[model samples]
Target chain A: MTAAYYAAVDWGTTSFRLWIIAEDGTVLAERRSGEGMTTAAKTGFPAVLEAHLAAVAAPAHLPVIICGMAGAKQGWVEAGYLDTPAALSTIAAGAVAVPDVDRDIRILPGLAQRDLQHPDVMRGEETQLLGAAGNLGDGRHLVCMPGTHSKWVRLEGGKVTGFSTFMTGELFDVISKHSILSHSVADAQVFSGEHPAFLAAVAAACANPALATNLMFGVRAGQLLHGATATDAKATLSGTLIGLEIAGALAAAGAVDSVCLVASGSLGALYRAALASLDLSPRIVDADEAVRAGLSTAAQAIWPL
Target chain B: MTAAYYAAVDWGTTSFRLWIIAEDGTVLAERRSGEGMTTAAKTGFPAVLEAHLAAVAAPAHLPVIICGMAGAKQGWVEAGYLDTPAALSTIAAGAVAVPDVDRDIRILPGLAQRDLQHPDVMRGEETQLLGAAGNLGDGRHLVCMPGTHSKWVRLEGGKVTGFSTFMTGELFDVISKHSILSHSVADAQVFSGEHPAFLAAVAAACANPALATNLMFGVRAGQLLHGATATDAKATLSGTLIGLEIAGALAAAGAVDSVCLVASGSLGALYRAALASLDLSPRIVDADEAVRAGLSTAAQAIWPL
Candidate 1:
């Protein structure tokens, strides 16, 4: 059996994921839980990390590299941000050590854009960007990382020049559950990116991005007038938001040498489709693999694997 | 005492307002209550109407002209929508009378844009438009009626050509209370249009309407980084949403001969500031007076003195 070199943990706002990695960059074991920063803050971050490591049979000597909300001000430690125009390589060097712990544990710092006009921040995504675009001998790259707060980063010459955070995912959630559109999409079933309503909405929003909220109103109005199904309303809502994100991202980034989408699951498919609908096909990278790779890179740098 | 000609009631989703008028168009008495359509639907609508009438000592022969949610499918009578491009005069002709009532009570119908691409409906705003812009001769007019669901209507030659609804107010309420930004704006104080943060946000969103959601995220990021006060965050939010609404409204409206604002109170002031920021000085009309004028016009049309 391969000996574990180190452990990697991606701690988010409401989720926890850990991987026991071998010396040869193999995942020996993995664990996922809902005990993220919010849960760990209450139940003890050290205790939670230890329990997960023990369950995975990770050795005491196995150094752990952490990333994400675990380093937030409200998290385990204040792993402060590295201001923007920041090189991707510095992300690994900026790993913050978890104090007074026996194990060699470190949490990576996030990225912050301090522009008063466009203030923005990202926690786990900076590391993800490092792993996803670290090796690229780039001119310029537009990296889209979708989540509760979808981030669009402008990477020029392997450095994050600036970035914008769109409240797309969060808005989708609140509008669906709390707004008047809730009634329209109350009975929505699982839908894919290829849904006609979704595609149509994407096209509409992309064509006229300024009519975003008006387009959103159409979701509910369509249901009332045309007897549109719940799925149609839900899909339209999803398409319109994703479409707006893409429009904003492109308009903000201007021209890019290449575009990369680092996302997974249903959201990845939707974004992929949204991009494709606009006649742009970005290089897709799996989000999980990117985060794990990021941790591995930072871990190797910190502990000299 | 002058004989009461008719009572004009603007029955909204959660608000009720009744104005007693004499045949000579003189104000007799006015009543405002919380018994809007929602409450009147539960308690008998006729009873609610009667109680208000009795409070003002209105005679049994005093007829009633109702507008807004009272005419909705869920209200007293199902006053169906008149499909656009409908003439403003048609609204009064579209009035549906309440059945099984001794009093001569009629509810004004709303306007519906049945266009597949942009489905929209306006309940009380149609009457407000009629009251505000009913006599505009042979020229196009853009009327903005700001409320919970703000409506921007395009009136051409006294006809309801088309209109768009921006979920600005609803989105603001939901986002402030439900999204992650809630933490940033928890202790927000009441801010007006004159606030610097509000004006700056309006300018930002107007400059790049696509960056709307990004600007929204900036509210939280600004709080996290700059220690922005809750009021600043709240004002920024308000400005961003209103700016997006204005941008979308203008983009969709193409161009018009004149712009009119039919609104009241603080919302009106904020919109006025937003429009002024974009160098637009719309003809301002009080919403209450406009609605009353609309009802008066429709009432005279229905039951001539």
Candidate 2:
């Protein structure tokens, strides 16, 4: 029998990625293209799918599961939102059925937080959460997904009870890239946490959260007065923002007791150290692995034996 | 005898503006061009000066005064800062004498706050303060200069002792241009202070300063949930930011008691009403007039008859 192939799509704002999977949930062929929601505006949805499929010679009909910006309001088709506290099993279990596909195509609904004093929302992270629960297996877990908008989510028995977002990455991008601090930072400065300069910035931000406004100028002061390198200054700025986010998140989520970070790449490792500074044990997991695992969970639901 | 023509140069990051003045400081001709610090990267001091002369026909032997980004470290020339409690007259009196100019050419030194726990800096706004002092003739005036980085300076007897910089304009630009709030706001919104909508937003920001962060999302929430028009939502966001800036500046400077604002233009007038909500009086003035008056103060100091 021909191996049943499944498709997983992580459609984001600036890029759309696709992974073709075999029956055993291994990625058969992966493809990435520039057809994100923003760029696919004039051409619209049909063009996005057609551009990605142009590379692969596959059967016309196949089961496909997708997540992320494709589910946003202005996306190809809005998948709406799954109100929290949402169960990982429930999230994996629920899918927005697509219209007019020769084969079954389901779009995942993102998690939404309302009815709280302050409402918050998330779209793609739900898939990551479901995948985390599947990988770690049905128990209480804390996941810190850091990006432009970092999400701190709590899962108990594979259900997402609550989550909060910190604009740390976006804030850093804005302040360091656009604000007065930009003058202090050089174009190319990427430092690791082991650096003494990085440690100094984390310590300062940790000591006084409000000092962020003033501490930003320290980059310039360091450069002008002490002749500190631009690379060190950039690292310091990043460390300061991450440290502040971690402190604020810990207080808000009460995650200091039991927190595990689900991040990827250098940003993930940086966050791991940031959490460690505040005496929190963090289990850093590969984000891509979780994305694949999530696709498997959805595939299993759709192709149950 | 022909009227002794004075020259005012407002050199900034991305643009250069100059006003040729008659003996009484009346503008004869004003010229604007994109020879700001950012554009004149390859060509240093001489290029910036030459760029100005190219845009505006000024006698090589004319008394000329300059300010703004040209004094920055990266500018054509770095004219050092004048420490506070600094009077405009003091900086005018101590104008940096640029060599090689046959006529009197003095670069005004920007003001800096010293007595405060942390120091603050101002370049172009010092000119605005001087203009306010020269025009209003001093006596406890509160001046608000709105721009990318807005400054609130408290002047008593033509002396700018202390001031605070609020990233109000920058924050608005960031949130509207980059943040999630951008979706809810329209391209432009008309200001009508008497409208219940406007007053409600001002009150919300004033009632709880910490709510400033929360208020930002209200623009989106108001549009999405409350059936608010995009224009109204945008206006509310703008009002809230400006209102927060006013409240924070007032509290920080301890100028709540008997404070009178010197604002410029209709946008300035709208802010005046926002200030009035807090039981403070604000007078609207012309922005161009303030710059001219400021230039005149600097000119008189360098070329005292």
Candidate 3:
């Protein structure tokens, strides 16, 4: 087995992932847990990182590189942010090292767009962008990273010109769990991309983006008047939000030659299907792999083996 | 004091209001409580109504006229709905009488737009619309009644052409209390129409309705980077939702010569200010008086002395 050289960690708000990589860029071991910044802040970031490193059997003196909310003001260390128009490569230089620790540990800084009208920030997704950028030999590209706070970035020749954060995922969670739509979707069965209601809603919202909140209310109205199923209600809600996000992202970004979607699992599938409905096929990149690749790029830049 | 001619009530989802009307259309006595449909459904709607009637010193034999959620399927009696394009004057003919009751108590039916794409229903707002219509006269008019679920109606002559319900107020409540924006607006101070943030947000959302959700996230980003006050965050959230509603309402209406705003108190002021910012000078009508006039109109139609 190749000896592990350095560890790469993505510590998010509510999740933690660590990978022990060999000097030649082969992944030797990996660990994932709920010990993200939120949990780590309470349990001790050092202890959380130590346990994950131990689980992966990482060498005690091995250098470690981290990205995400762990570098936030409320995270493990304040790594700060790189303001736009920011060069993706300069992210490695902004890494804030953890002092007084036995091992060499560094956390990558996030990216911030200070535009007065569209001020936005991304912690971990910037790393994902850095990694995804390498795959697209770019003139201009639109990158979408879908999650709790979905980030839509505009990349011009390897630099982040600007980006917008749509509160799509979080709004879905809150509206589904806390709003009046909760009752409409309580007994919802799991649905997918091909659901008629989902496709219809995507079309409706995309066509009339101004009627978003009205369309959301239609979920309840549909249930009341047309006896719409819980699955239908849920799908409509999901599709409406996703459609609105896509519309907004496209509106913010003018004509672009290529679009890249950096997402993983079910969400990635959902976005791909949503984009297809709009007649655009995005070049897909696994979010997990992109973040790892980003961390790897930062790792190699900071420490040459 | 003139003997009570009839009792008028506006029973909503979370609030209840009762007024004893004299033969000359004067409000002889009034009573208000929190015994709305939700509470009255569990506590007994008849008993709750009796308590309020007693408080207002309403005569036991006096007939009653009611509107709002009290006519909903879950309320005291299912008053059903009058489908659009409906004549506002015909509302009184659709009143459903309370069975096995000593007095002649009739609950006015709501309005339903059964459009396959935009199914919508309004329980109480129809009454407000009926009363406001008298003031609007003959013409193509767009009516905006802002609340938890704001109703935007298109009135051609005296007929209800179509309407849309924007979940603006409810979305604001849920997002402020449940979403991440909650933190940014936690310490918000009370703001008015003149707030710069509020006006700016209104303009931004009106200009780019597709970017509604994106603008929402800016509240948080503004707080983090620009040191935005909690009031600014709250105002921006409020403005974004309202602006989205106005934009959607107008987009759905197509063309209108005049706009009528039927609302009362602070919410009314806010909507007026928001509409004014969009260069729309809506003809204002007191929602409280409008509902009362509607009930009076229905009462005279049902039991003319």
lDDT for A252 (candidate 3): 97
lDDT tens digits, residue span A1-305, model 3: 78888999999999999999998899999899988898999999999999888876778899999999999999988999999999999999999999989999999999998899899989999999999999999688999999999999999999999999999999999999999999999999988888889888888898888899999999999999999999999999999999999999999999898999999998898899999999999999999999999999999999977
What is the C-alpha RMSD, rounded to one decimal, of candidate 1?
Answer: 1.2
Residue range B220-282, candidate 2, lDDT tens digits? 544543567777766777777777677656655664324545555666766777877777776
TM-scores, one per candidate: 0.98, 0.76, 0.99
lDDT tens digits, residues A1-305, model 2? 44647778877777788888887656778888788778876578666775566566545677778888887778867887788888767766667877875667788888776743335677787887777765555556678888877777877777778776666676677767667667778564667666666666676666554344344555655565456677777887887777666655555565333576778888887877776766678776677777778877877887674
Candidate 2 overall lDDT versus native:
0.69
For every candidate, the chain B TM-score is 0.98, 0.88, 0.99
The DockQ of each candidate is 0.83, 0.13, 0.87
Question: Residue B66 error for model 1, in Å?
Answer: 0.7
Highest-DockQ candidate: 3
lDDT of 1 by residue, A1-305 (tens): 78899989999999999999999988999999999999999999999999999997788878889999999999999899999989887888888888899988999999999998889999999988888985455688999999899999999987999999999999999999999999999999999989999999998887777788899999888887888899999999999998888888999999998899999999999999889988898999899999998888888888784
Candidate 1 residues lying further than 4 Å off, grouped into runs, are B134-137
lDDT of 1 by residue, B1-305 (tens): 67889999999999999999999999899999999888999998999999999998999888999999998878889899999999998899999988889989999999889999999988999999889975456788899999889999999988888999999999999999999989989998888889999999898887788889999999999988898999999999999999988988999899799889999999999999889988999889999999999999999999998
Q: Best lDDT goes to which candidate?
A: 3
What's model 3's lDDT at B162?
Answer: 96
